[model samples]
Target: MKNPIAERITDFIKNYHPFSELSYNQILQVANTCKVIYLDKNEILFKIHDEIHDSFYVVATGAIGLSITSDSDDVLIDKCDEGDVLGLRPFFAKDNYLMTAKAREETILYAIPIADFKPLALQTPAVLDFLLQSFASNTRNPYDKTHKGKLISENVIYDDHNNEIQYYQPISYSTDPITAAVNDIVQHVAQIMSNRRIGSIIVQENQLPIGIITDKDLRSKIATGLYPISVTLDQIMTTPVITVPENLSIAEAQMMMLKYNVGHLCVTKDGTNQSEITGVISEHDVVVSQANNPGVLLKKIKRAHNIVDLKLVRDKMTDLIQHSIDKNIPISHICSIIGELNNAITKRVIDFAIEKIGTPPPSKFVWLDLGSQGRKEQLLLTDQDSAIIFDDVATENHENTKHYFLHLAKIITKKLNKIGYEYCPADMMASNPFWCRSLSDWNSQIRKWIQNPGDKGILMTTIFFDYHCIYGDENLANALTETINNEIENNELFLAFLGIDALKNPPPLGFFRQFLVESDGEHKDTFDIKARALMPLIDAARILSLHMGINKNTNTSYRFAKLAEIEPQNALIYEACNEAFLELLKFRTEEGLRNNSNGRYLDLSNLSKLDKVKLKNDFQPISEIQEVIKNRFQLTYFT
Candidate 1:
C-alpha cells in the first residue's frame, strides 16, 4: 500500500537541492520516516545551546528566521522560506545548536530523521558532498580565513560567489612602496617607474611622504616643456600628496579617487601625511582589484563623446547598484557614491548640450536637480525632476534670455533620457516654460507658493522645494533658495498645509499587521511602498526641516538626523525615522533591481514571510513620527 503523505513529501523535497540530487526511490524512503510539525508566528523550533535533535528540518511553508543572540540584540542574519533547509547542524555535529530558529509566521516544517537519511546519504556521493559543504558554511565571520569553514557558536554566514562582499573588505595595497627622495632627478625617478612598469612613485623626506609623481606629471612637466627632465623631483612632483590610512576598502578607494581627482593615494601609518608611508594604491591597482567598478565607470562617463557611450555607462551603473545592494554595503555610503556618479553624468550631458548649440549661455545660469535627485537619494534610474535658474536679465532681453536657457534645458533633458533617466511624466522638468526662469522670477515664484499654499501651491512646494545645483552659477541657485526659506518663515499656514498633506497617507499597516495593499486598478493587491511608506517620512522631514531653517541637509535621512539633534525631546522618534527611511530606501532599491521597475508597488503575496516581517519592523517609526507631526502642527482641528 502506498503512503500518500510520504509520497507528497518526496515530491516537494525533490524540487529543492541536495534532495533534488537524490534518486526518487531514495527520497521516498527518507520521507516515509519524517514527521510534520506546525508553528505559530514567532514560535521557536530550536535555540542557542539547546541539545541537538534527532531530525533536521526543511521549511515546507511560510518562513524561518535564523539568528544569533548577542549582548545587545538578536540579529536575524538569514531566512529560510519555502523549500529552504535548516536544522542541518545535528547531522554534521553532535554539539548543541549555536543559533536560534523561529517561525517568522505561521509555518509547517518536515522533520527528516537523521537515522533514516544518514544511511541514504552515505550511499550517494552527491548527497554526501552536499552535506559536507552545508556543514562547512556555519561560522561567525565569513571573511575570516582561518575560521573560514567551521561551526562557531551556531550562527551561519551565507556564502557568496559573486564577489559582492569585496565592497567592504580591506583593499590590499602595495606595502613595499617604491619611493624617491625630493632630491632625486626627474629623469632617474621616471626610469625607476618605467623599469617597474608602474605609473606612480612617492616623493619622501625623513621617511615621510611629501608629494607624488605620476605619468601625467612627467608628460605635462617634462614632455610638454613645463619643466625639464633634468630637474629635481621637488620642482616637478605634485606636493601636498593625498593620503589615506591603510585598510581602506575598495568602495572607499574609488570614492577617494573621484573626490580628489587623482590616480593614486599614499597609505601612511596614521591616516595623515605626517605619518610614514606604508603602502601605495595606484589607479591600475584599484582597477585590477575590481573590474567594471565605479572608478572605471566614472572614467568612461567622463570620456564619453556620444549619447550611446554614456548609455552604456549608465547600464553598468545599474550592475554596480545591484552588486552594492547584494553585499549589504551601508545604504548611506552607496547613495553618496551613486549620487556623485549621477551628478557627473548630468553635468556631462549639459556640457554636450551647450556644445551642440555651438554657443554659450546668454547669462550665467544654474541647472537644478529637484526632487529625489536633489536629495541625493536617487539610487535607481527613475523619472527626472529638474528646474533651471538663470541670472536676471534686462526687461528688453528677458524673453530672449529665457528662450536660450529653455532650449539648452530641452537638449540636456532629452540627452539624459537617451542615457537612462526617464522624462518626468508630469512635465515638472527644467525644459518647461514655468520651470525655466530667471533668478528674480524664481524668487517671486517660490514666494507665491509659500505665501498662498492652496492645493496647487502645496503640490508645487513638494515637487520644486528640494533643489541641488548640478551645473553652473551656484550663487544663482543659492539666491533662489534663500528666498524660499525666507518666505517659508512668515508662512505658518503653509507648514500646516504641508503637515496635513503628510498625514494624508498614514502608516501602511492595517489592523492585525496586514499590509494595506491597493484595492483596485492594474496595481490591485500590490502594496504602494512609495505612497504608503516613503512619502510619510519624506513629507514630515521636509516640513520639519524647513520649519527649523535647516538649509544644508537635503537628504531625508540626514534631515531626520538633524531634526534629532535640534529637537532633543523628540530625538528618539527622529532617530528611529532616520533608520526607518534608510531601511525602506534599501528595500525599494532591492525590489527595483529584482523586478526591473521603480519598485514602488510590491506584490504582497509573492514575498516570503520573513521579508514581510522585516518591512513591518520599519513601519513603527512612521506611525510615531506622524503622531509627533500631528500634535506639533495642531492639525487635528485645522480645516
Candidate 2:
C-alpha cells in the first residue's frame, strides 16, 4: 500500500518544474512510489560513479551539496536548497552518477521514482526540455549562474618539484611498413625483421592484423628448435593479438600492457584485432611514456636486497594509494593491488628474517597475518598483528623450537616496525610466546576459546579468526581452520554469544538521525568509525560464517559474498553488507590520508552535510544485519 506521506510529497513537488507540468493524478502516481528519506547534516546521498538510483531526489527542506572530488580535494559544484532536483542527469543519461550529492544540512527529500516519472517526462515537452537544457549546460538549474560551463569532477593538473602526473595523453606508436602474410615462411619473416632492424612484426589475414611475432617468440620457438625455419609465420606467431584503438592514451596502454603481461599491443582501426592494422606500441614504448607506475614500483621491490631500499619503495606505495583514490579507481581493485604488494613486502621480510636467524627453521611453520592484513583490507600502515605456528616437535626439542621461532619473529617484527608498521599495542605479535606456538598448542588454545566462550575468548576469536597464511605451510593453517569451524558447528551457544558481541556497537545513528559521536576524550564529538561503523560488519561476517561452516574466507566482503552464495534467500542483504563494508573502508582510508592518522575518529563537524548523511545511510545495513543475527540466534531470549 502507498503511504499517506506520498500524497503529501505529491502536493509538495507539484509546484516544482517538470512536476508542475504534470496533472494532479499523473504527479500522484509518481509520488506513490516516492520514498521520503531524512538526512542528517553532512549525509551523502550518492557518490561519483555510483550506480544511478531508480529515483531522483528533490530537496523539500534544508540544503544539499553537489560536489566533485579531485586529487582528494572536494569542490562544491552546486548548493541545492528547497525545490532543487538532484541526481536527475544519471537517469536521463542511463549512466552512473558523475558527481556526489550530499546533504548540506538536516534535510527531508522526496525521492521520485524515475520508473513512474519517466513516462510523464515523455508526455510533457516542457519537463523534458527543462532536463535537457539543464544537462547540456552542465548545471542543475538552467537559470542559476553558480554552476555552468564546467564538467563535474573537473580534471585538475598537479605539478610539484617531487612529482608530475599526466592525466591522459595519447600514446605514440610506430605505424606502417611491418607486415607478413600467414603463408610467409619463418625464415622470410626473420629476414624481413632483420632488414627493418625492428624487434617485432605483425602477421596479417586479409587486410587486418591477425597475430604478432616478437623477438622473444622467435627466440623461444625457433632458437630453441621448437619450430623449423621452413615453418610458416603462422606457426610461430602469438595468435589472437591484443589490440587497442589508434587513439589509446599512454596511461591506458601502459596499464593494459601490464594487465595483459604483453610486450607489444597491436593498434587497429577499431579496438578489435579483426579491424585493419594501424600500428604497434611495445612495452618499451609504454615505459618511455611514464616513470611512476606499479610495474616500476613492483620491479624495484622485487630487486631490493636491503630493508632501506624496500622502505623507499614502501614510501612510493603511499603516493600510489593517493593517486589511485584520486583517480576514482574501484576500491576492490585497489585493495587487491595494494594487498598483493603488502604480501610481497612481508614475504621478503620473512625471507630476510629467516636468513638473519642464521639457520633454516627446525620445522615447517606458517606465518599467520591477523586482523586487517589477513582480510586484505589494510591500505595505510597499521600495527603488526601476526603469529607463527610450527609443526609439533619431540619433547626434548619443544623449548628449543619455540625459542628459534621467537627469535625469528622478533627480527621480522623489528624490520617491519622500521618499514612503518608499528608494534601491536596489545602484543599480538609472533614474538609473544603465547601467540607463537606449536601446531598442537595452537589447536588446543583455539578449542578452549570456542568450548568456553567468555569475554576474553570472544575477543581473542575476533582477532585470530581472520588469519591468512601470508608465508608458510598452508596445510597447517588449513587444518587449524577446519578444527575451529568444526568446533563452532556443534556449539550453538557460542554462536549466540558471538551474535550478542556483534551488536555491542549499535548503529551509529541517534533518534534524531544525528551521528552518535564520541562524547569526550581526545576525539570529543568525533565519530568512532572503526569501532562504531566497521567492526559491526566485520564481527557479523565472522560469526555468521562460523555458524554456516564457511571457513578460511576471512575478508568481510568475501565472507558476505560466500554467505550470499550459501543462502540465496538472504543474498540481497549480504550483498548490501559487502557494498557497505567496501564504501566504509574507502571512507576511512580517505579520512586517514587527509588527517595523516588512522582513519578511526572522524570529527562530525568537519564533514559536509552530504558526507554526514552518507555516513548515516550506511548504518542502515548494520541495523538490518543485527536484526537478522538477533532473529537467527534467537537473541531476544538472552538475558
Candidate 3:
C-alpha cells in the first residue's frame, strides 16, 4: 500500500547522494518507513550524548541546525537545509549522538530509518562506500589496519653550496642591489646595469620595491619590440616583487624562486614589501652560490632535457637525504632542501609535459601539491597527490578547456610515475578529472564541501586545504585559498566539524601508559608512527591554523610555531607539539632509510630503551594538544 505522504518524501530523498546512488524502488521502500515530524524554532531534535536513534534524518522542508555543547552555550557546527541529510553517523557506529540537532526555524524532517538503509547499503557497493566515506570523515578510515598509507621507494640528490655541511647555512647576497626610479627610462636603467656589470635593477618608490627590471626584461620588452627603450622602467619591470628575509639559506632562496616562478628575489629588512630592500639574489647568483651542491642539483633540474635526466637527478637526491640523516642534520633543514629539490623536479616535469603536448596551455593554471607533499614533509619517496586549477572559462569552452588540461595532466603524471614518484593509490592526482578543474569550478566544489562538511566533506577539506603551488602561476592557488578562507569566515561552523574529525584519534597510549602497538595483523607487534603519533599533531595544527585564518603556510611544525607566537599563553604546549613532530619525523625518516620501507610501521623489538623513552616523551604532547583542541572548539561534550 502506497501512502501519499511517503510517496512525496520519496521524491525528495531520491535526489541526494547515497540515496541518488540507489534504485527508485529501494528509495520508495525506505521512504514508506519514514516518520515525518515538525518543530518550532529553537526546538531540539536530539542532544549530545543522547541515545542513537534507529532513524537518521533528511530535511523535507525548512532547515535543521547541528551544534555541539560548549561551556554553557550550543555552538553551531553545520546547517542542513532542504534535501540535506543529518544523523548519518548512526549508520556506521553504534554510539551516542556526538551533536545536537535542532530546528533553526519552523522545520519539517523526514526521519529515514537506518535499519532500512543499512541492509540496502550492504547490497549496493556505491551506497555502502558513500556511507562509509561520510562516516569515516576521510577518503578512507585513517585507523583501518588494512589502509596503512605507504608507498614504494627507489631513492633521489641535492649538492650543498660547494659542500653538504654548508648547504643550510645562511647565504650571502649582494647588499648593493642596483636600483632605478619609476620615472627612469628603460634605456637609462639598462645603461646603468651595463656600466655596473649588473644584470638586474630594482625600481623603488620611497625606498619600497615597486617592480624590477633585468637583462631578460631588456631583451624581451625592448630588443624584441614589445616596448620602446625610451619607455619608463615601470613599463617593462615585473611587478609585485617576490621578497625574502635577510636570513634565507641557499636552498630556501632557490625554493622561493621556484615557488613564485621568478629569477630574482628582493631581500628586504623585514622580508616584506612594507620594508626597505636590503639585498638581492639572482638565478645566476644561486647557480654560482655553490659549485657542486644543491644549487647544482637545482640547476640540473632546471636544465634537464627529458624525463631520463630528471630521473637521474631524483636518484641522486635520495642519497643526499640519506647523507643528511646520517650526518644528523636537523630534520627541518633536510626537509627544506629535499622539499625544494622535489619541487624543482616537479617544475621541470611540468615543463617537459608541456613540451611533449606540442601545445601551450590555453590559459594560466596552477599545480597544487596536497597532503604531506603540500606540507613539504615528504622526506621519503612516497605517493604523490596533486591537483590542477586553471583560470575559469566560458560555458561553451569549458569542456574543451578541461579536455586540454586533462591531456596535459595525464602526460605530467605518467612521466612522474616513471621518475619514481609512484601513482597515488587512491588516484588523487592532477590526471584525474575530479582533481583537475577550472578555478570557478573548484571554488564551487570547495564551497559545497564547506557548507555541507559532515564527515566526508571535512576529510576532503583537510586534504585539499593545505595546498602548495608546485608549478605554474602561484596567483591562481592564492586566489583559490583566498576564496576558501573567505567562505570559512562566513561558515565558522566548518571548523567545528573539522574539530570533530581532529578528535577522532584519541591519546596514543594505552591504560598502562605503554606504547599502543597493533594487537592483530601481519605486523601485529608494530606501531603505526604516522597515524598514532604524527596525525594527531598534524590534525591539531591544521584545525588551529584554520581557526586563526593562517593560510600562508602548510608545514605542521611551522603552523605550531606560528600558533605559539599568536597565543603566547599556550606557547609551552604549542612548542611541545612542534618539537615532538620534528623528532618523530626524523625518527621515521631514519627508519625508512634503514628498512627500505615506507617507515610507517615500527617494530617495538627494534627500539632501544632510550629510543623507547624518547618516543614515549613525544606522546605526551599528543595528549596536551588534543585537550587544547577539545576546549578551543568547545568539543568537551564530544569526548
Candidate number of the best lDDT:
1
RMSD of 2: 18.8
Worst 10 residues of 3 by lDDT: 148-157
The lDDT values for all models are 0.81, 0.79, 0.79
- Tens digits of lDDT, candidate 3, 397-481: 8898899999999998999899989899999999999999999889999999999997879988999987889888998898888
TM-score of 1: 0.58
**Cα RMSD (Å) per model?**
22.4, 18.8, 26.3
lDDT of 2 by residue, 99-176 (tens): 678888999998877878787887787787566545543445654445433322122222222122223334456887
For every model shown, the clashing-pair count is 1, 17, 11
Model 1 is weakest, by summed lDDT over 10 consecutive residues, at: 157-166
Pairs of residues at least 3 apart in sequence or in different chains that clash in candidate 1:
98-154
What is the TM-score of candidate 3?
0.56
TM-scores for every predicted model: 0.58, 0.59, 0.56
